[model samples]
Target: MTDTDLDQSYSAVCEALAQVGEARAPMLLAMLCLSLMSRFERADQVLPLIANALAQSDEGDADGR
Candidate 1:
């Protein structure tokens, strides 16, 4: 997807989270991930993405950014 599409997707997620509120936010995200994962042809394609996201999350935690 293009950067513009990514921006739109990010905004959509933020909106969904806002609507669901804190209690169900994590569940909503997990559900969304599962829905997106179905579109992928293979686990191998998505495994690296999950790792990269975790790595980025770790870096964010390290710097407190």
Candidate 2:
């Protein structure tokens, strides 16, 4: 898919997650990974997803819950 298509897909997923509310947001992270992986042919696309995951993971770690 093109970058535009990927952006649209990302937006749609974000909307869906918003509609579902906070309780389901964590599950969508996997979908984001899969969607981004499938949509992006370039290696650069993967970096953003990896970075986001790492950032979120760090946040969770820092929260100490």
Candidate 3:
């Protein structure tokens, strides 16, 4: 999928999470992570990319960028 498709899918997931409420947020995140993990042939290879992306996002949010 293209970046736009990924962004839309992410937004849709956020909307679904909102509908499910904050109390279930952790469970939902865990379920989503595990579901994604199941598809990886070499999780180690992709984990650094995921970690870097998350770190960048966190930094951007912190800096209000």
Write the residue-wise lDDT of candidate 2 on 1-65 in tens digits. Answer: 89999999889988989987899888776676676588788889788868997899999999994
lDDT head-to-head 1 vs 3, winner: 1
lDDT of 3 by residue, 7-34 (tens): 9999989998998899998899889878
* Worst window of 10 by summed lDDT in candidate 2: 27-36
Candidate order by TM-score, highest to lowest? 1, 3, 2
Q: Candidate 2: TM-score?
A: 0.45
Better of 1 and 3 by TM-score: 1
Looking at model 2, residue 9 earns an lDDT score of 85
Clashing residue pairs for model 3: none
| Reference-based lDDT, each prediction | 0.97, 0.83, 0.90
User: Is candidate 1 or 2 superior in TM-score?
Assistant: 1
Clashing pairs in 1: none
Q: Which candidate leads the pack in lDDT?
A: 1
Tell me the tens digit of each residue's lDDT in model 1 across 1-65.
99999999999999999999999999999999999999999999999999999999999999988
Compare the candidates by TM-score and give the number of the best one: 1
